[model samples]
Target: MTRAALVTGGNRGIGRAIAAGLVARGVKVTITARDRAEGAEAAEALGCDWALADLLESDSLRQFDGAPFDILVNNAGILPSGSLLDNPQGYFDCMAVMVDGPFRLTLALAPGMIARGYGRIVNLSSGWGAFAEGLGGPNGYGIAKAALNAQTLALSQELPGNVKINAMCPGWVRTRMGGPGANTSPEDAADTAIWLATLPADGPTGGFVRRRRRIDW
Candidate 1:
């Protein structure tokens, strides 16, 4: 069967790699990014569909006219600089993408998957999200990701067991957000994501995973 997959922030970074991997597997992939040019170019390069969306805009996503997908990968996120105290507004900015957007999208799309008796959801999380690293302060990005992990677990339980849902901690990939000298490549980070996406109906759910090993959540 031809499976459909949607990946957010697919213009670049780990999201791009995950989308490419899915396309390589012959999945009909749709990638979403905020930038039209980048999103279009990436989609063209990968021979996939592209949708322009700023996940923060709930109405924008809600009003989006698109085909229902069998798989949804919430790979979009942002990292604003500065400490939590210095960047108070950063919390809202981060939550808009990481928490609010994924929550709404998952809620909107899940019923279809349940009705069909199969679905795959990959909610991208972070190692920092597992616990309070001294690195992650009250910053919006960190907190939102942590909260996102919780949401992933909660949502997984609500879905049919055949609809496998899991959170992915991609490690520290060498993206613009990860900065220079980051150890993991987008390709490496994407491995677990693609693996989770293509799982069998009896696969695990409500788990936090990296390389298939359950993480502390």
Candidate 2:
């Protein structure tokens, strides 16, 4: 049987690349995006399934239909910009996406993953998740990601033995969120995500990795 996987925000950028990679590997892929048209187009291109769900809504997660996905990539996130002095709302939006969304989705899916006795969860974190240097564009974005890294470590320890959960700092990738001058491409970031999703049974967990090397939290 083919392994099943879901990639949120998979209509474009890093999420798109990761979904494509999983589909190419013969996994049954599902890509979720806020835009229905875009999500459908991406799913068609990748030859996979598609769904539209806004992370801010709890009902959005309930639509998963309880499928036992072998892998879940929580790549959906927003990077709203504002300085710490003037970004009050930005902080709330960041929390809704980077922190609350992932936490809820994982909780919703954990039982099925545990029951399967074989599962992989890859959370798309960032280099800023560890060290906070040079991340001044959006104070809320960096702060949310940093909290996500902590969640990854904490969640990993809570997972069952047969399931492997890890966080990945994909570095600064060239995407809408990464901006024009970013050095890396979505393809580069997707490599590590795909690697983590398809890890062997004995693979590492509760780890933060980039380019296959472990990084400090």
Candidate 3:
């Protein structure tokens, strides 16, 4: 059977690149975007399917609960809710977009994956989430990613032998959030994610990796 993949926030940036790479590999791809126009445009350009799903909304993922996807890339995120000192709304917003929604989506999809005896889950995490890096990103971004890392680890233990779940740090790239001066391009940042999403059954799980190599979590 042909493999299928769902890439969240795939209308642009690193998510977009991941979708493109998967399509090039002959995988059926469905990309989600909050905007219809953007999502449709991207799907047309990439020769794939598109869906209107907002990660911030609680029920946005219900529609995909029955889709048979061999790969899931949780690449959607937002940077908001300034300093932790303020205990602001954006902090919760960050968690909702980066952590909560992804977890819910995984829960909705993992069952089908297990029944099929094949699955690959890749969480797009960050160096900022690492204690070695001192949880450095602004706007609670670091905190949200750290929680995502924990989810990746916990899920790995429960997922079966044929299924693999891991987190990877897609290095800073020149995207909307990374700005123009960043050192990498979206496609370059997408390399590690593409690798993890297509790993062999024997590949590592419940680990944090960057540039295709294991890194401290």
Top-scoring candidate (lDDT): 3
TM, every model = 0.94, 0.95, 0.97
lDDT of 2 by residue, 18-114 (tens): 9999998999999999988999899999899998898877688787746678899999988876676787888888888889888888887778989
89-163 in candidate 1: lDDT tens per residue? 787888999998988888777887877877999999987787834326346776888899889888877777988
lDDT string for model 3 (100-125, tens) is 98888898889999999999999999
RMSD of 3: 1.0
**Superposition-based RMSD of candidate 2 using all C-alpha atoms, in angstroms:** 1.6
Residue pairs with clashing backbones, model 1: 91-140
Please count the clashing residue pairs in each candidate, in the order shown: 1, 0, 1
Candidate 3 local distance difference test against the native: 0.91
Deviation (Å) of 89 in candidate 1: 1.5
| Model 2: number of backbone collisions | 0
